[model samples]
Target: MSQVVDDSRGGAGPFSRFEFLVAGRYLRARRKDAFISVIAALTLTGIAIGVATLIVVMSVMNGFRDELLSKILGLNGHFSAYPLEERLTDYKETVGAIEGVPGVRFAVPFVEGQALASGLTESTGVSARGIEFASVQKLDLLYKSAVMGSWDGWDEGNGVAIGSRLANRLGVSAGDIVTLVNPNGTLTPFGRTPQIRSYPVSVVFNLGMVEFDSFYLYMSMQAAQDYFKAYDDVLVEGAEPPDVLATDEEIDAAYQRVYRANAIEIFIDDPDDIATMRTRIQSQVTRPMTMTDWQQRNETFFSALQVERVVMFTILSMIILVAAFNIISSLVMLVKDKGRDIAVLRTMGATRGSIMRIFSMTGTAIGVAGTLIGLGLGLLIAANAETLRAFISNTLGVTLFPPEVFFLSTLPSKVNAGEVGLVVALSLSLSFLATLYPAWRAAQYEPVEALRYE
Candidate 1:
């Protein structure tokens, strides 16, 4: 017994060489205590899995929100301005005025409305935007995301640009004809009828967002106005017709009216400073207009995302907590199994603190190793999240993240360093605290009683 205890009692300082050797020996449990070894391994595995899962889930949620926001803002601008009363017939002047304001990047006056679009094979409802060729050029996202065809002659030619998804559903491509049916038509004695017109598909774009790709399409401003009949100053319901011999000026006045814009989409230099920019824009513009920022428009969607992130974090944390309990149980069993060994060390001049330190070291080592492994694993999985999703979908023959359901074309992952750090700190802290109760229990064992039982 003396010889057995000699090697474990030589070191003097806290957590010394002798203490580590004893802890290591106990961790590699002998055949008699193999069950305790199994429990310790399970504890390590649980901690690692819990940490990895937490990191991956949180990163995915962050990426989802970030990706959605970027795509939405890219296509829709930072905010939009709509007229309070009457139509925006003076849209050109309004766009110029908004563009001149500080912090304003550019303002585009657009006419947007709902219409049923028909291709040869399929038909679907679309939110159609009427924008000029120059305005389309300024839209960097749409300009760059073109999958097929060119924007050349888009405005000059009476053609429209459709999303790739819409084109696919319609079984049409660039140069193919698509018919648009506007439900709100000119009032007649027989009541309003749907206005139907056809135009060539000038270009195809892929916005990478399901809603935009599948439900939104673009056409020339003049085409949209003519199709929707968005004109100001309509003549009376039964007004007298102008005479055929009327002067040229009278004929022009009776026939032509100003085209009206539904809203003006404004892009600004700094999206975060939207409130200040909004105030400045309103002050400079003369017309009575109402403004709404992107955040205001999608508040409910983003709020739900935030809430889900928090809830997922809280739920996943419990996994680590359960692993902590495993650490406590495994350490308690190790202490009981090594009671005689602890007593012999105590009798050979080893302090009670030394007993506590040895058991604590054993538990903490499992925690440290597990935490390091989990951190690496978590980062690796997060970095390749999209790739993995693709692989799984291909192998399984089912879409894991369908664009129509998820609203994103791909699975996204963005690992926040701060969040990873917090997960590691939490795991390590729980592991260390779990060791205290078992380590203290081992330290309290009396050598006389433990040896007597042995």
Candidate 2:
């Protein structure tokens, strides 16, 4: 009975410490088959490239998703409340009650209508939003983002705001007069007729999104009410008139007292809370109608992105699978070259299981080392993709991704821990699995046969 001197400095079990030693010896030993070393190096390089690409691609996807989400939510209110079919008579009271609801940040009565804006050179259809100018300023970040003019002018009658794209298309600047033509027009005793009015472009805003920048316009609630006659007359014949619509000026005065005087729109800070409030307000106040959040509005675009991501990931993973096969080939070649050494070890009392363990550990070492190197490289690239792009562009006079085509002006990347972890685990598992057959074949060799061949 030989005393097993604790070879491990920590007095750990013999098998535990010996496995590492065996793995190291096998890896360091020079072999005649230089092809095996080349194959192993290729395998490592393959894994590193695959991992790095996946990380960088996924990070870009995440950044795009985040950028679009912020732009959409930041431009549009989280939720809106409106009348179902009938115009709200007591909007102030309704908005007040809604303000008391949990998560209600701001509730402002808004009216939307389409009109053609004509400048000196061009005329384009635009979406006009009627809101409390001061309240809207607080809710919309665009007020602060104005490129020219002042948002304060929106408080005055006949004041309007236009996007930069629309301004350029119309060849107009701040203080320029633009004609607003409402196709639906106004109702009178004679008949419905188109209403054409002129308003000064009080402010010019630029939000960066092409669609919004090209079509969005803003006006004060008073100006909108006057232009659209949204508060004027009931369409019904001989219907019992409410105490409200007594006369034109009287009705306007009444609306001013009842609604505009005390009404203030509240915008909730949290997106989740805003969503909840929207749902609650719709259920309680508005009639059943299709409503969509900004995310859902662009579902197809987002869905396409997701599909692209999945396809890209699948394609990149094949590179790793190919590398795993390289690992298998290297191990097989190594086993063949060391046949005589394996036979001697067996004769010296090494079991087949121990032989298998040794080869498996060797394959695992290659995989783990490659994965760690890849992970570090991938993270570095993802963290500084923009800087890297800038450097490449400057040094080589070549752009990685040009800003003109891409919605974002620069390369965007956001590394997710979970995604990196998944890549690492996947590579390790594939490498371990690749070792099984080669290791098993080496272990199954008969000592006499292996010694005879050598």
Residue pairs with colliding backbones in model 2 are 105-266, 105-267, 105-268, 106-266, 106-267, 107-265, 107-266
Model 1 clash tally? 0
Tens digit per residue, CA lDDT, model 2, 1-454: 0111232222355344655676677777465656777788888888888888888888888887776666666656555444555456566667677667676666667667899999999899999978776566556566676898887656666778898888999999999999999977766798888999999988898776666678898888878866766664433443444475377754443343322221223455676554675677666654332344544567698889899988988998887899899889889988988888778767766678777877888887788878888888899999998898899899999877654456555666777889889888888999899999999998998899988845
lDDT of 1 at 21: 82
Off by over 4 Å in 2: 1-17, 28-33, 118-121, 137-140, 167-179, 186-200, 233-279, 282-308, 388-411
Off by over 4 Å in 1: 1-14, 233-250, 253-256
Report, for every candidate in turn, its global Cα lDDT versus the true structure: 0.89, 0.74
What overall lDDT, based on C-alpha atoms, would model 2 receive against the true structure?
0.74
lDDT of 1 by residue, 213-254 (tens): 898989999988888887865654555557989897766666
